[model samples]
Target: MSKKKNKVRPLPQTVGINVPGVETHAHLDMEDFKEDLPEVMARAKECGIAKIGNVFLGPQAYETNRSLFDAYPEVFFLLGVHPNDADQYTDADTQAMRNAFKSDSRLKALGEIGLDFYWDRVPADVQEKVFRTQLELADELDVPVVIHSRDAHEKTLEVLEDYGWSGKPLLWHCFGSDVATAKRILDNGWYLSIPGPVTYKKNEEAQEAVKFIPAERMVFETDCPFLTPEPWRGKRNEPAYVAFTAAKVAELKGMDVNELWAICAKNAYDFFGL
Candidate 1:
């Protein structure tokens, strides 16, 4: 027999604790996972994610989120109309969200909501209108807000300045801006969530932003099914891969992976009030 064919691999041995993790933002309701959600959640648990903050982005995402929470209890839900979905927000949609807020404390935050002037499929005016409406709803409901801003940082900050957060908890998810923009968010007492793109070779802007932000205010995410980190960049990402993002963050912040992991988990717990 050839040496390659005769190779004996050792049996997999029991490993000690992997880094306890949290995927701060993900779309578990996305169509990609529709058929295999149980397997996906099982993988996440096996990889040591203590919680997943699922983004409710579709007409059905809220119901999907509710069902996940009911079924898994460990999964957390945050509701929002996505920027691309600005055209879909009607009085009925907003009311559905409000009713969910009234009915479930499992609904922890209002978001993945903000301006996306990048595509402008919806007019800037429409995006602003929907964003302001959601922010108002968040303030009225007294829940934190998770913001998704892309190529509209000034507009986003301007809207926040104009309407004023009025002491509501705020989070800027998938933060891809410069150090200045990161500083503005940090200065306003909002949290900044970094994602897998931080590990990309050409993502210097993201890396610079991560370097400047204070570790205490920083959080991590996969933004999965998108922004998959290196070595797995082209594959469909799941919460199980969040450690790669965290490892990248640790490299940037010059801390041990476990230290950063625990710090981020603590920040998430404090931010989401879990």
Candidate 2:
């Protein structure tokens, strides 16, 4: 008789808490979960994650993972060229993004795009050009935009203002800016997607931002497999852990966790039309 082989499955590192909400930003298509993606999605659902916006960083990423929208009905996508990869963006890439947006109803927005001075991989001039190009694409398509600004908040807002972004829907994803910046974002009528950083004790700015931003204009995200919240910091993040961010923000706002979740979920739905 041939000996039988036993296969052992790995346990999910982060268990999701049962708190229904929407994770406004994540990258489920990334290679980080190549082996355990099914389990990750299941855990997110079990944790009451009703919907997720899976952002694609570039044309290649979008082309590779475009099937995820049909595979998971709860998962929508945001296609754009990230500022870090701005140098590599081409006319062909822009056309591909346009085609994808046109063909897929699940393509909710154009984003994870903006300025990132911290990396400095692409020249600031090139980043701005790519940023403006994508913004124009979003404007032409009449879709919302998700922005990623790091160490370039002033420039980011300047570009948005220059583009006459007053009437469009804009989301500042993973907002870690100061109170004044938050107020400015609010003044521009842009939504803010809070992330796991709010759960950290040292993230006073995030906490303060949450306090000032009204409930209607606020949303939550995981930005996983990154920015794992407190108690799971330094570990891989996933959609399920977005609850921690909600709980922390709720506490800061002196509201019940579920109430905050519902508000943010509705805000996400309204903003992304999910």
Candidate 3:
């Protein structure tokens, strides 16, 4: 008697309109793409990404954002020193960010900004100073802000509250924090941007947190070239794979993927004013 063989099949490829999406945050100038940005961006365009929100860290990246804007119309710019690079912000750097934010309507938000105690590359005080200053700058410009919070949620919230973010649009990017934290952020009426990692197995925290975010206040992102979802984890992420992230959100929210797509797309469009 011959034994029957079992066949394994690959996951179905994602298909749908690559409607223009606004990546809430990504570091395209991270030196990881120093050699092949053209190919990277080509794939991004092919994937239906209409715009990329690139965050600049210091003086060099600050300038790079301006240059990139002139070079690639599809790429949008945000100016702020990242938490890890907090020490790099000088009076000149802050002035540069302010000037860029003031002069260009294209500069949408002050971002990639917030607390990150995980690496502790800079002193907590320095991070707080830079974060607060940028927040003030964003407030002055009447522009929304994108925040990068990790391990220092309490302090981050405290600072934002102290700064009085009562009527501003705040984006919490790549949100993988706890439900309680999500509730706090939501209570403040800020938007939580979900990324691909929500699809990962055992990512209960992210899944739980996403449940409380209403569709209108939630946005989708790939944070591309990083945080690629399951079945594609460990590989470089791209804009096209954001469908996987949206699919995961749909599953978590108990809604149809199409509905989730529409809701997320609207939220993104409004958030970026695109």
Candidate 4:
């Protein structure tokens, strides 16, 4: 068998049209971008990304690493305790998140929160408790919700419905599920944030779901520092890579990349209330 050498793929800036776009989710605060974050931000800007939502795992991360993106005015914030960290949620953390939201105008949504049966770091009951608590907090704050369900979609949907989140400002992040799942999300009046994996040929379900999802209800996210889109797969993902995801979605929907890019950006801006 021959060894498969790395291919020299085109940079993200070369993948999509130079039209304004938005990266609905990112984690630029992670150690991956610590060394060359400035260069990454520059490339994202050059690739025509207008705004980027930087998600903080919890109140502490928001307080500690939120400032890292202050210099980039186009970056917004999303804060929540992840399901994997269910045991870590406390009343104090809740208070801290409340305080942060009250003080920071950049915090746009309560996000990356929900079920994650894929990882057994936390018990199901504990994860449910934490998820419900954050959902309650989101309602109290009247903020939008960004979900992070993994292999627990049915449970996540049931919980959202139970919380009366239908027709509310909600986003299903990294939605690489099937048409039925996409329909379920849309039926609940929630937005679907298509991630980089949708560009992969193996992710045919998501690709087909994209065709079924209305452009008005669709948005693009790199989920960066993760889910690096092809042409750049196996590389560290950054906000710039969102352009490639948006480009691929446009191609799948038979729309112009520039137009689709702008539409998704607009949808994201409206969803986040930017």
lDDT of each: 0.83, 0.87, 0.78, 0.91
Candidate 2, 82-171: lDDT as tens digits: 899999989998899898999989889999899999988999999999999999999889999999999999999999998999757999
Which is superior by lDDT, 2 or 3? 2
| Candidate closer to the true structure by TM-score (higher is better), 1 or 2 | 2
Cα lDDT for residue 33, candidate 1: 85
List ranges where model 3 is wrong by over 4 Å: 1-18, 69-71
TM-score for each candidate, following the candidate numbering = 0.91, 0.92, 0.88, 0.97
How well is each residue in 1-274 modelled by candidate 3, as lDDT tens digits? 9988855422313545345555566677776766777877776666556777777765577775456547788877777778998887778877777777777777777787999999989999999998998888787778888889889999999999889995579988889989899889988888998988898989988898888778888887777678987767777776667767777788888987767777777787788776
Cα miss at 61, model 4 (Å)? 0.9
Off by over 4 Å in 1: 1-19
Q: Which candidate is the best by TM-score?
A: 4
The per-residue C-alpha lDDT of model 3 at residue 1 equals 100
TM-score, candidate 2, is: 0.92
Pairs that collide in candidate 3 are none
Candidate number with the higher lDDT (3 or 4): 4
lDDT of 4 by residue, 1-274 (tens): 9999978788877875677778989999999999999999899899998889999998888888987987999999999999999898999988998888888899899988999999889999999999999999999999999999999999999999998999999999999999999999999999999999998989888899999999999888988889988888998889888888888898899999999988888998898888
